[model samples]
Target: MSSEIEELRKEIENIDKQLIELLSKRLKIAAKIGEIKSKVGRDITDEKREQKVREYWYTYARNTGIPDSLVDNILPILFSYSKMVQINPGKKKNITIIGYGGMARSLASLFSLVGHNVVITGRNKEKAERLASEFRFVYMDLDSALNWGEYIILALSPSSMDYIIKISPKFSNKVVMDIFSSKNEVFSQLEKLSEIYSFNYISTHPLFGPLLYPVGERIVLIPSKSTKNLEEIITFWRECGLNTTVSSVEEHEKAMAIVQVLAHFYILGLDRSVEILKKEFKIENLSDFFTTNFREINKIIEKVNNILPVILEIQKSNPYAYKVREIGVNELQKIRKELGE
Candidate 1:
């Protein structure tokens, strides 16, 4: 029995080597495509082509007796790698990221992947150094980072924004951006500071979490009066495998009122209600009996709980937050009345 097991393991290892070789060939082909795309000034991601490929994979999977779910799981990873290989930045940037948090790590990972020099800096030098070491980035004091960097990303929490104002002098003539979701007062303050300090200010909200590489996430850019190289910045982000949307500060705030404010408001309320119901019903665990919808909701609830601080900050700062929450309450009340609950 041991001899048979060893023989089967050897066969598996041989297949794994063949798979690696095939993947290498695939990536080489993708690199060539990237070269051609660069010459033609085409974007790295071709969604239509990707969709066609997915459809082909689906049909091929069905015909070959392979599980459709396996194809679903593998295609996104393949697409991410394909985009990674295809993206050719016009110039390597000297990027300084403030805050050694998940978002900082995510951005640093992308920068390292795309051959950019990255510096991570914050109040906690040790934490910054730890995060920088992960991606071969430099860890430095804020003054040094600001001096060395061409582009600066403020990945700090909203509460830590005072650092920007305090160190305003270091930002002279540099391109700067903040990744705060709720723009309201913070945007105005940053814009004013940029003017006072003579720096390029572009407010940005990364419409995704701190996932590594984040190869096809959307980032909304709200250009202030001081923003001059908007097109150049957009091209830079596109080459980094991010889709960019230009929006006014007002429009961005209004949209987030609906997206973050309304959604998080209800999710928070729902989470509490779930906890209360569980206690009232004396139910200790619902995982064993969860339906697909319930499981998906549970995942969302978990994510919300983890990011509650940022959610609460958005809830407080968004101008239209109260109106949206009022609408949510009214809708829920109406449904309860109709159901006579």
Candidate 2:
């Protein structure tokens, strides 16, 4: 047993050294790409190139007898390497976000860690000033916002973005994105921005919950073809531990209607079912016996509970949302009939 342990430790140390050397070379290559991008005014991420790399990795993993799931987990690390290389290769970029929530804090830290300046803006001058003071970054008023930073994020609540973007025209040449859970409303406002502006407006949904990020995560991007500069920003997040993928605004809305909207409804139903079961007949020490992941299920329950009401509100407001909800109900009935119960 001692001999086996020693051999494994030696193997791991050898692998780590080789990994460091390869990573150093990879970062050098990414820095070269970033330099070329800066010169040509092109974005850092080549989506076509990323796709090619993904296929290559998956094929290599298969040939090596590695499990598909293990390969999938490694993908985020690869993207992280690409991002870390682009931003720091040993330098950083300046970034500003128009909110003070989790996404704001995360982006601020991400940009800074990569060696860039980060600023946070808020709804009021006082609040914005206060946040800036806390972060030791600059604050901006409505009239005299700084035109600094190549990237700006609108990390506002779902209800308030239209008004926010309406008056912030200084984002003219810069790339702007929103971390809004839904894309329709924000895009409607971003659409009003002039075509003459050198802007790329994309909708981003960071899939991980606010509590944990970059561990096991993916970020869905809904970008207008008009907003081509999103490539670098996407790659940046990919390195910061997000698996960035593109979806059309239409596709995002359709996918979320089911994944976000109806899935929330189903989880709510499950919670209610569990409640009724507990009230009627208690299980025998089942709660204590549940696996560790069962505790994590509580987190999912919290997520669904929080989002259920909002999705329901959207369903009430939109005709398409109503149709989608109706389909969900029909599907539930069919499921019930198909089951023996």
Candidate with maximal lDDT: 1
lDDT of 2 by residue, 187-206 (tens): 66675563445476676887
Report the C-alpha displacement of residue 61, candidate 1, in angstroms: 1.7
Q: How does candidate 1 score on lDDT? A: 0.88
Stretches of candidate 1 off by over 4 Å are 1-21, 36-49, 337-341
lDDT (tens digit, per residue) of candidate 1 on 1-26? 99999999999999999999999999
- Residue 146, candidate 1: alpha-carbon lDDT: 95
Name every residue pair that clashes in candidate 1: none
Q: Which ten residues in a row are the worst by lDDT in model 1? A: 37-46
Q: Please report how far candidate 2 places residue 190 from its true position, in Å.
A: 1.3
The per-model lDDT (C-alpha) reads: 0.88, 0.67
Best by TM-score: 1
